[model samples]
Target: MDFARLTGLIAATYTPLNERAQLKTDVVPAMVDHLIQQGLRGLYVCGSTGEGMSLSSADRKAVTESYVQAAAGRVPVIVQVGHNSLDEARELAAHAAQCGAEMISATCPSYFKVTSVDALVDSMQVIASGAPELPFYYYHIPALTGSAIDMPEFLQLAGKRIPNLVGIKYTAPTLFEFQMCQSVDGGRFDIVWGCDEMLLGAYATGAQAGIGSTYNVAPALYRNLVDAIEQQKWDEARRLQLVSIEMIRTIGRYPFHPAMRCVLGFQGFDVGDCLLPQPKLSEQQAEQLRSDLQSIGFFDWAL
Candidate 1:
């Protein structure tokens, strides 16, 4: 398959819920429109940012359908279908393809903890086979998945086994390993950077694209960072990167995803709060978050 590499900023989108924490899919269209208007280049549905692991399989499918329909070919929607059950992951991948998603991605099953490159390849092959016509990207977030298989080796082996395998969503901070993954098969894979705060470093190491949760709220800031890099303005790029670091630090003070929802609320998106196991912010906490962000001029530059 001749895959068109994903370039520019792609948002790891959030799943909206109601007060009861049920799926509030009606908000999806508005969310998609807002992301595109904010200059995001693509949408990554049902990833960590979207609480994919927490949602039921049915809800994941619904969210995939909603995002794909909302995007309507305006931007590519890459559905993250990873599940502990390979069968469920395969089903989700097929459903994403059936619903018209442009690509599919999945993490290795976390519960069993794949310990070998061959095991990782076999596991992903089961998921990618379901969406044989569409491109597949292995979601390599070792911190979350607990499967820290060497990416360069896995890419080389999986490339031969999985016919539609295109590349990886490299999320770890190890730029050395990331660069090695990029060099595999003579740069055949589309290794998209996943860490938003370290995006400048990734660009310095030859990253062509990035998929991150922060891109949802701060696309303009990252766009300017990329622009500075493209224009060879090292000082401006470093300054913009520092702004992202500080912004992430402020959000990190609270439970990350819930605070991200609070930030979205500030922007009038009404995305509601994260589900349990990820706590929601109180009124006072939300106010304090707003103040911290204001102190850093986040509202001014996040646009």
Candidate 2:
């Protein structure tokens, strides 16, 4: 495994959208640079936070290609290309690999509740076939996808039957679920935690990387968490965890996708509202997040 493949924080970056709600590819490269400056280990583009579902295939490809080129091999960029359509997901997997994405991941296709685990397995197998040589990580989030892959289901996928299946971004709520994945793999497989609030516990339970929504505002905070663990400062690490959990609670409580885009605005990226159904928060909610940010010294750069 590459050093970039080892453990750290991978921010599921938000897309910079235009006033018309189209992806702003220009705004992406700058954020990629900002993340690198803050010491982020990698980035996960086109995931839930990026409004991947709303983006057209061409748009997602453009964004993925642009970031891969702009990164210029500086840091690992993992592209989330899974969607309702298997063909599109396959295309995305191949596109990402061609564009230099370090790893490719896909969430469970959620629109339908199928008869069995084979439904999910078939979706992954199709995507793997699309990118025959690229390494793949399964995106396991039962809440969002309305599909759960218990330990037995996961083991079936990770077995020799599936080539290019190296790990999973287990987005399950509890660290116990992550611990279970570690147990089945003898604690050696890469499991990236998808919950920011649970990241420390996830890491302690053997997660290699953290993939989260709140990371858009606080990549450095998480990068520090990893370092604290390395130094074995358990108590001090808890302080950072407390700070991060508070932020997650604040962000997670609200309509997340939009509130997050607003914060990105203040930070300098000018992305627009969340796609329909994921509407931008009320003006009051925006100000509240802004105030919360100021209270936490998020604007300290101005000082």
Candidate 3:
């Protein structure tokens, strides 16, 4: 296991698509350059923001390949391989390791959800074993998974069963459980905060890193947020956190995925639309979104 600590803003990137919502692997290089320019610490590919669950396994593999290729050792790439099927998740995990992804992460199986901590640990162990060489982080986003098992307990059980388990993408709102997870085994795990809107609260609990969709659009704001909090500049950190919360709330008025894609389009990526069932913004809506963001000074705060 590589055990290298993942810190700072790890952007949960959007999967670039063509007008037909096909994977536009070609756009990844430009996307990489755009993020690097924003000073992101790492990339979290094929996760919630990337619409990983909506994509076919082949498409996920292709996106992972494109990101690893484009990053070209510039930054660490953590690939999310969680799927409803353990075999499919294992397959993707294997492919991620083969392609040189720095780490692999997975959320609970949602369709036939694992309701018990032991069951969740069993599920995670199988997935982690597939990529034994790479560091593995269990993605704990109960809001989406509905697993709702106690995370602190999950970590205690998972730590013993899965040797490669290094940390978690701690996405739940329960900060008390989050604090317990962080303090497990004398702060043994690297708990990266996943809720973008309430990041300051997480930072106060000793969260050194975060992963979020908003980081894709405004890396400077979050990078500065991290700096401000670290420097004990509470006033500045609070202000930045409010701006982030407002920006997310504004874009979230529409279907969040599509609106964020539109925001990226505004950033010059032309990453295209979110896949169907996720909804696509009309050109008029997209224009209005851009105008609204501008009115709120998103561009000014954005990198």
Candidate 4:
């Protein structure tokens, strides 16, 4: 199937929660509306930013359904259904298909660690089989997944094995490797760039699209960056990229995702806190984070 390449910024969305940190899906519609208004091109749900691994399978499905229903076909929604268990991942992929998601992506099982390109292909094959009709993009984040199987080789092998294989959510900083992946099969795949801080580099290296956590709060900044790149405004593009780097650095002072959720709260989302293992910001920390963000002029240009 010929899938239209995903372009522009796709927000790896935050899963809204109430005070109890339970699934507060009632906010999904408002969140979706806000994202669309902010100029994000698509929605990527239940990925690392959404705390997919921490949530129960039931919660993941609920989140998927809420986002899909709220989106109402305004934009494409790509569901990330990666799990440690291949069987559960397959089930999640099928559920995403039934829920009307436009695409599916998954990470290789991280616990046991996939050591070979062939094994990586086989693991993805099991997950891709469940949603054979949806386009599959391998979610490659080696820093988190610990499976740094050579992507160009995996794409080469998996292209023949997985019928719905489309591309990759390439997250690492290796631009050379990313370029090689793009060249595979004469550039047939839709390789969406995943690192937010390095977007300018990716665009210069031929990235048509990007998916990232930071896009949720700062869509306009990235849109401007992409616009500047396309218009050959080299100075403006570099400045914009530096702004993003600074923004990420400020957020990195705390547990990154929780601090991001705090930023979301500042934008009036009521997204609550991240799950237990990820850590949450204290009131003092939240205050400090807000001050830090302000110091960087985040409120001026972030929207």
lDDT of every model, 2 decimals: 0.95, 0.77, 0.91, 0.95
lDDT of 1 by residue, 51-144 (tens): 9999999999999999999999999999999999999999999999999999999998999889999999999999999999999999999999
Query: Over the stretch 1-37, how does candidate 4's per-residue lDDT look in tens digits?
Result: 6788899999999999988989999999999999999
> Where is model 2 more than 4 Å wrong at Cα?
1-4, 185-188, 300-303
TM-score of 1: 0.99
The predicted structure with the larger lDDT, 1 or 2, is 1
Candidate 4 C-alpha error for residue 142, in Å:
0.3
The C-alpha RMSD of each candidate to the native structure, in angstroms, is: 0.6, 2.3, 1.0, 0.6
Clashing pairs in 4: none
Instruction: Please give each candidate's TM-score.
Output: 0.99, 0.92, 0.98, 0.99
* Candidate 2 lDDT, 210-242, residue by residue in tens: 877777677777777778987889997898888
Q: Write the per-residue lDDT of candidate 3 for residues 227-263, one digit (tens) a residue.
A: 9999999999999999998999999888998999999
Give candidate 4 regions above 4 Å deviation: none
Over all chains combined, what TM-score does candidate 3 have?
0.98
The C-alpha local distance difference test score for the whole of candidate 3 amounts to 0.91
Q: Lowest summed lDDT over 10 consecutive residues: which window, candidate 3? A: 1-10
